[model samples]
Target: MTKESDDNGNTPITGDEKTSVPADLLNIEKGDVVDISSDDALLMALGYKPELKREFSYLTVFGQSFGAMGIAPALAESLIFSLGSAGSVGLVWSYFLGCVALIPVALSLGELGSSMPTAGGLYYWVARLTPTRARALMCWLAGYMNVLGYISIFASTIYGATLILVAAIMIGSDGTWQTTKYINYGLYSATTILCFGMTCVPSGTLSKLNNTYIWFQLAMALAVIIALPAATPKEYINSASFVFKEFQNTGFWPNNGWAFMLSLLTPVWVVSGFESSATIAEEASNAARAVPFAMVSSLLIALVVGMGVVISIAFTMGSDVIAIVTSPLGQPMAQICLNSLGEKGAIAMLVFLWFTSICNCSMLLVAASRETFALARDGGLPFSSFFRVLTTNKTPARAVLFCALVTLAEGLLMLVNTIAINSIFNLAIMGLYFAYTMPLVSRLIFNEFKPGVWYLGPKLSYIFAVYSVVWMTFIFTLLLFPSYPNPDETQMNYAVAVLGFVLVFCLVYYYFPKYGGKTFFHGPVRTIDEVIATNLQLEEQLVRKMTEDRAASAT
Candidate 1:
C-alpha cells in the first residue's frame, strides 16, 4: 500500500487507522463465514443502515448498467462533432483506445464498490476511504461533483436524443421541416416528462423496463452492424487503404496530432456512465459480488458491440467525409444512413436510433434520481427530507421527477447557442471521472481496501488505482482543451469556466450557515444500534432457512 508522510517524515495514519473494520467488533475475515451480515455489517461499520430493498439479481443490475451507457446511440450522435479532427482510422481506434484506458478506471471502481455498497457511490467511497480528519471535506467535494456530473449527463443525453428525432422529422418532411429552437425545447420537455413518469413507477416495474431496453439495444446494434455494410453501394464502400491509412484534419486546427488526441473525447464520452451499477448498488442483492461484476461485465459487453458498430460505420460511412458531416439535414448520422441506405432503409435506421435514445434517456433518469435521493438522504442537498422520500414501492419518486425537470430546464441552454451545449456534456466526463479518481487515490493513501466477496490482491490493485489517478489527470487537462482552435466567443470551450463556477459554488454552499453548519453536513453519520440489531434479525432468518432446507433433505 502507498503511504503519505508529514513534515516529520512519519506516516499520518497510524497502525489503528490502517484497517477499515471497526475496532470494537470482532475481526471476522470476509468470505470465511456464511453470515447474512457481511453487506449490512460493513454498512453498519461505516454508519449507514440498509434501507433499500435488495431485489435486483446480478443480471438485472447488469442490464441497468448496459442500458445506461447507451454506447451505440451515443457514438452515432456524437461522431459528427469530432469529424474535423478524425478520419476512419482515427475515429474507430480512438474509441477502443479510450475503452482500454478506461478499463483500469472502471476496475478501480469495481474494487471500491465491491468493498462498500452504498448509493452515494464515489462520494460515500471517499468518505470511508480517506483519513478521519480530511474525510468530511473531501467527501463533501466528491458528492457535489458527482451530483453535478449526472445532472449534466442527463441534459446531454436528452439533447442528443432530441436531435436524432428532430433529424428524423426533417427527413420525413422532404425538406419542409425545420428544427427551430422551440422545437428542440419541446422535444426536451416531452422526453423529460416521459422518463420522469416512468422512473416514478414502482421499483419492481423498473427492473422490467431495464430488461426490455437491454434486448432492444442488442437488436438495434446487430441490425446496424449487418445491414449498413450490406446495403452500401460498391463505390461508396471504404477500402482497407482508406480505413486504416487515411487521415483528415479539415477543422483547420494548429496541430493534427493534438487535434486527433483531443477528438478522443467523442469515444470517452460515449463509453462512460458504466458506473451506474455502482450508484444503484444499494438496491442489488449481494451487492459486494453483483455490483463489481455488473460494472466490469457491462463495459466489456459495450466494448465488443460498440467496436463492431464503429468499425461497420467506418467501413460504410461513404466516400465523402466532408459531405456527411456538413449535411443540410442538421443530423450527421441521419445523413450518413441516407447516403449509405435508401430513403426507406434510412428511415428505418433513424427510427432505431430514436427509440434507443429513449431507452438511454430513461436509464440515465433512473440513475440520476437515485444518486440525488441518496445524497439528500445523507443531508448533502437542500430539502433533504423531500428528496429522500420514497413511494409505496420504495422508489425515489420526488427526486426522480425533480432532477429530471431541472435537467430539462438546463436544456434551455440549447436556445442560447447550440455550440455551447458541448460544455454541459463535457461536465459529465470531467465531473464524474474527477470524482471517481479521488476515492481511488484516497484509498491508496489511507490503505483502506479490505478483502470482500470480490477481492484483488494488494499489489495488483494498487497498480491500477495509482495508474487511474495519472490517466484521469491527463484526461482532465484534455477535456478542457478547445475543440476548435482560434474560436470566436461563441465557439470557445466554456467547460473550464462552468466547472470553475461549480467548484466555487460548492465551496460557498459548504460554508453557508444553515446548510453545512447543521449536523447533517458532517461527513458520514455514525451507525446507531438499530442497524446492528436489524442485521441480527436478518441473520436469524438465514439460519431458519438453512434449517428448513436440511430438514426437507433428510425427509
Candidate 2:
C-alpha cells in the first residue's frame, strides 16, 4: 500500500483507470491532496473540473427528459401538418407503427448513455470512441451539428406554442381580434425570456418544478383523453374514423413511399430528442443508470399516453377535418377542441396547452444550455469562457441566455421567408440524429469501449448500434428530397441548405486556430490519473515526514 511520487515529486497515479489532468491546473507537489470522491471528480476524470452543481435527482432528471418530449403539445402542433401530408388515418397508423423504427434507436442510444454519460453526450463519446488521429475533427463536426439541432428544436417549439396561444386568444374573441406575425414573434421572444428565467434557477428548484411538469403532462393528457370522448356527442364521435377512415390529402403529396415517409416525421419528431437525458447527464446524481432509463421511459410514456391522446382528438375532430386542419385560427387542436368542447372549454384547454408548451420550452433550453456549456468547456466554441461561465446559483446562465437570443434570431428569419422555415425546424432531426449516429458507428467499427455500470449485453448491443447507423443514414437521404414536392410556392427543402451551412461553418471553424480550438482539442482529458497522482504524492510526503520525526526522536 506504499505510494511513490512522480518525477515532479508529486503523486504518481496508479491503476489502469487513471487519467491525465487538464493543462491549466497541474501545479501540485508531494502531499498535495485533492478530494476525488464526488461527482466533480467524475468531471475531472473526463478532463474538466466541476463547474455546474450536481443536485438533480431521479425525478427531476426524468421530468427534464419527459418535458423535452412534451408529447401532448408536440402531437397537438404536428397533427395538422401530418394529416395534411397523409390524412387522419395515415398519420395515426404511421405514427403508431413508426414506433417500431424508433424503438431500436431509443434502445441503442440508451445503451450508449449507460456507457458514457456526459454533458457533451454524443460528441463527447465521439472524441472518446473515435481513433486518436481523427477524434478532434469528428468531435468538432458532431458538436456543431448537435448544437444547431438543439437550437432549431428550441425555436420551433416556442414558435409552435406561440401560434397555439395566438389562436386561442383569437378564438376567445370570437374571431374578431386579428394579429400579425410580429405579435407571434413577440410572444416567441417573451416565452424565450421565461425559459431563460427557469434556466437561471438553481438545480433543485427546476427538479421540483419538473417533477410537477411530468405529472401535469400526464394529468392533462388523461383529462383530454377521457373528458373529450365523454363530453362529445355519441352521434358526432366515431370509432371507425380513428381506426380506419382516411381524409382526403388534397394533393399535399402523391400517395407513395415518400408521402408515408414524410408523414412519419410527425411521430419521429415527437421521439427525436429522447437523447436530451444523455445531454444533461452531468447534472444527474446517478447519471449512468438514470440517463439510460430516462431516455427510454420518457418515450415509452409518450407512445402509450401521447398516441392515445392523438387518436382521441382524431375521432372527435368532426367530419370536416380538412376544414379543421386548414382553419383560419392557425391551430388545428384549438379548432378540434372547439368542435368537441364548447367555446369556454376550448379556450381553457388551449390555455393549458400553452402553459405546458412554456414548460417544454424551458426544459429544451436546459438541455441546449448544458450541451453548449460542455462544448465550450472543451474549448470547442468561440468565447468558450463566456458560455462556460456558471452563475452564483451554479447554473449556466450565460449559455442559456445565449440560446434564447439565437432562438430569437431564428424567429426573425421567419419574417423573411415563411415557407422555407420548415427546413430550419427540421434541422432538429437532421442534425441531432446524424450527430448521434457518428459515435455508434465508430464504436462498431473500432470495437473499443469501456462499459459502465449500465450496458446492454455484447451481442444485442452491437446489433442495435448497427441498426441505429443504418436507420439514421436512411432518414438523412430522405430529408434531401422535398417534403411536398413540385417546385412551387417556395416550399423547397431548405433543410439541405441549412445542413450545408452547418457543414461549411464547422469546416471553416475547424481550420481557424485563433479561435483556439485547433490545439488541445482532443477528447476526454486524462482526469482520473491527475487525482490519483496527487493522492500518491500526499501519501509519500506523509511517510517521509513520519520517518524524519522518528529519526529526531531516536537521537
Candidate 3:
C-alpha cells in the first residue's frame, strides 16, 4: 500500500490502499454516495480539472450546436450541387434522407459525450474506449482529423460568407461589378479575423452571443421561408409537382442515381456540428444532460426548419434549374432570390445569408479552439504546453488564435482557383466524419463502453453505432467523386488528396522512430487524484452533518 500527496496537497490512496475505504464513506450506501454534483466535479472525474467557465446553459449549448450547423445558410452555399444533380426533387429528398441517416450518428456521439464529456470530444472518447495497445494510435488519428475538420469548417464558413457578400454586392450593383479572386481572398481574410475576434470575447459574453445567434438563425430561416415565396412573381413560382418531382442531371455522372447520391453532401455537411456541443461539454452547465440533449434536439430543430427553408426555395425557384446553377451571380441561392424577389429583395436576403455565415464562423471557432486545447493538454501536439494555455478569463485564446491563423492560411489556396478552394468544404465533411468513426468503431469492437446518463438502451446503442459507422462510410465514399466526370485539373475533387495527406501525416507523426508521439502519449492522462480528494472532502462534510444531526436528536 502507498499514499502520496497530490498537486492540491491532498493525500490519495494508491495501489492496494484503495481497498481500505474511508470509515465514514463505508457507512454510506453505494447508491447514496454522490459522485458528481456539478460540472466541475464531473470534469474532475473525467480526468480534467475544471478550467473553462460553466456559463452555457442548455439553451446556449443548443445555440452553439445549431449555429455551427448553420443549416439554412449552409444549404444556400451548397444548393448548386443538389440543383445540378437530381434537380428540385433531389434538393428536397436528399436533405430528408441525409438527415435521417445522420440521426443515429448524432445519438451515438451523444451517448459518448454523456459517458465521458470532455473538450477533446471525439478523440478523447476514442482514447478511453479503445484497447490499450491501440489507444495512442487511434486517438492520434481522431485528434488530427477532428482538428483538421474544424479548421476546414471554419475556413469554409468564412469563404462561403465572402461569396455571399460578393453576391449581395453584385445584386446591389445590378450586376455592373464583378469580383476578382484577390477581392474574394481579401473578404475571406477579413471575415476570418472578425470571427477570431468574436471567439476571444470573455466566456460570459460568448454565452450571451450564442443565445442571440440561435434566435437570429431561426428568424433568418423563417423570414426567407415566408418572404421568398410571397415575393416570387406569379410566372416564376413552380408547381407542386415541379418542386417535388422534378429530376435532372447536369453533371456528367455515368448514372443519374449516382448523381442523386452525391447530392447528399449538402445535408451531410449541414446536419453536422451537432456533436460540436460535445466539444464544449466541460464548459456547459449540467454537461451530462445538457450536452446530449443539445446535440439531439438542435439537430432535430435544424432538420425541420432547414427542410422548410429548402422547400420554400424550391417552390419559388425559377424553372431553369440549369440557369440557376450556371448563374453569373456566382451563387445559386443568390440567383434564386434574384429571380423570385427582384434586385432589392435579393440583396436583402443575401445580406441575411452573409450575416448568418459570419455567425456560423464565430460559433464553430468556439468548438474548434476547445478541441485544439484539449488535444494539446494531452501532449498530442508539438508545442503542447503553449497551445494549451488558457487566457486570464479562461478562454482558449491561444487555440483561437491558432485556428484563426490556419483559416487565414487556408484562404490562400483560393489563389489557385475556386475549384481548389472547394476542397476545404469537402475536407470539412470527410474529416469530421472520419474523426466520428473512430470512437464508434472502438466502442463496437472492444465492447467496453459503459452507458452514460443520456444513453439509449444497450441494444439500441449498438444498433445506432453500427448504423452511424456504415452511413458515414457511404457518404465519405460519395464525396470523393467529382461533380463532373472526365474532369480537368481545375474541376477535379482534390479532397481525397488533402485527406490522404492528413492521414499520412498522422501515421508518420505517431509511428516515426525515436521522436514518435507513441513514446510519450498514453491515453488520456488521468487527474483522478483531484476528483478523489474532492470526493473525500464531500464525504467528510456528509459525515460531520450526520453526526451533528444524531446528537441534536438525542438532545
Candidate 4:
C-alpha cells in the first residue's frame, strides 16, 4: 500500500507490507512482523516516546510518596483520638499491629511489582491473574473505587489546611475562627483550585517537586516536635497521665467508645497513599526495585514520624486534650499548640500544618492523574483513546486535565452542605480501601500458586494475603458506620451515596459499548510470555543497532 526507504537507500517495506528479508539476516521468526519507522517519524505521529530514563533511585521514590503532606497530618489527628481512648499503651499496640500487618503485605506487593512492572500496577496484575470474563469488570470497579479514595484524600488535605490557616489567622488577629458551614465550603473551593493548578505541570517535573515537598514535611514535623514541647504548660503533662474519670456522652454519638472507634478511621485515612507509588510503576525507572522500596520506606517513615508528632503533642498539651478535641477549629494539633506554646507558638504550628496540607494536596493530584491514565491505557474506562493521548513531554496530559476537572467539581459540590463533604469523604475512604484490597484478595482466592520470580513462598504469601483481606474488610465495615453521630441519625445517607456511585459504575459498564467495554474480560489473561515477548522485541532492536555500529566501525 505504501513504500519507504531505509537509511542505506534500500527499499523499506511499509504499511503492513511483508518483505522476504532473509530469516538469518534479520534473525526474525517467519510470522514475526517488524515495523521500521524512524525515531523522528514515530515521534511526529505519537507525540512522545516511552521514557527510559532511570533518574529516580529507591530512596527518592519512597520519600515522594511517604513524605507527602497528606498522610501525616490526617494520621496525626487519628493517632491523637485513638490514644485518647486506648491511652498511650493502646496507641502503641495499634502501631505495632500496623507494622506487623504491613510487612507481609509489603513483601507480597514488592514481588508482584518487580515481576510485572506495568503502570496499571495491581489492576494489571489482577487482569492477568483472574478469570477472563471478570477482568474488565474488576478493573473498572477498582479504578472507580480508587478514584474516590484519592478524591477523598485530596479533599481532606485541602480541608485540613484550610482549618489550620483559618485558625491561625483568627487567633493572630483576635478574631474567632468558628468552623461554620459556609467557611468550610469556601475553604474547600479555594484549596481545590490551588491543588488543581499544581497538577497542571508536566509530569516529568512533578517528581522533583514532590521530592522538595517531602523535605518540607520532614522539617515541619521536626519543628512541631521541638517547638510544641518547649512551649507547653508544665501542668499539661501531669494531666495527660490522668486516665479518663468517666466516659462522657456527647449527643452526637452514644458513648465515647463508639466515638473513639469511628475516630480511628481518621488515622487510617492519613497513613494511606503508600500505594500511590505503585500507580507510577510505568514511569518509574526500574519500577520493580523502586516501587517496593518506596512503598515500604514511606510506611515506616510515616509510622515513626507520625508517632513522634502524636506523642510529643500529647505529652505537651496534657490536660488540654479534651478542649482541643472539642475545639471549633476541628484541628486537634492546633489545640495542642495553643495549650503548650500559647497563642504565638500556636500560630506558628498552624502555619506549618497548613503548609504540609498544601504539599499533600499536590502529591495526591499527581498520583490520581497517574491512576486515571493507567486505567484508560488498559481500555477500562469510557473514551479510552482520548486518555491514551500523551503530550510532547510524554505525560498523560489528558488524564491529568480530566482528574483536575473531577476534583474541581467535587470541591464545588462541598458548597451544598457539610453532609455532602462528610458523605464524599467517607465514601472515598471506603472506595479506596476496597480498590486496594480487592486485587490482593482476588490473587489470594484464585492464583495463589501462580509461578513467578517474585513468589513469596506459597504458605506465607497466602496467609499475608488473607490477613490483609480480613483487616481491610474490618476497616471498610467500620467506616460505613457514622464516626460522629448516634445510630438513629447516623449518616446512613452516606451509604446510599456509595451505592449510587456503584450504580453509576455499573451503568457505564453495561451501556458504554463504543470503548470496547464488551471485550474487557472476553479473552484469557495475558501470559508472562506475552509480556516478555514485547520486552524482547524492544531489546532486539537495541541489539541490532549495536551490531550495525560495530560493523560500520570495522569497515
Candidates ranked, most accurate by lDDT first: 3, 1, 2, 4
The root-mean-square deviation over C-alpha atoms between each candidate and the true structure, in angstroms, is: 8.6, 7.2, 7.3, 8.8
Better of 1 and 2 by TM-score: 1
The C-alpha TM-scores of every prediction are 0.88, 0.87, 0.90, 0.78
C-alpha lDDT of candidate 2 relative to the true structure? 0.74
Cα lDDT tens digits for candidate 2, 240-323: 745466555533667755666776667777766577988778778767778888878887877888778878876787766678
Better by TM-score, candidate 4 or 1: 1
How many backbone clashes does every candidate have?
0, 6, 0, 2
Off by over 4 Å in 1: 1-42, 514-520, 526-555
Q: On residues 1-555, what C-alpha lDDT tens digit does candidate 3 reach at each position?
A: 122335874343222221223333323334453333345545655677556777788999899899998987888888877887888988999999988777888888999998888899999999889989888888898999999999998888788889889999998887799999999999988888889889998889999999999988898899889999898998878899998886877667869898889778788877777889988887888788888898899888888998999999988887888899889988999998888888888888899989988888899999999999888888888888999988878889999988998788878889988888977888899989899999999999998898777879988999999998998988888888887788898888878878898888888988889998888988677654544565765434333333333343346
Report the C-alpha lDDT of model 4 over 150-201, residue by residue, as the tens digit. Answer: 7666765666667677778777876654556567667767777787777666
- How far residue 7's Cα lies from its native spot in candidate 1, in Å, is 46
Alpha carbon lDDT of residue 421, candidate 1? Answer: 71
- Candidate 4's error at 555, in angstroms? 37
Give the clashing pairs for model 2: 11-537, 19-526, 19-529, 20-526, 31-537, 31-538
Would you list the clashing residue pairs of candidate 1? Answer: none
Among the numbered candidates, top lDDT falls to 3
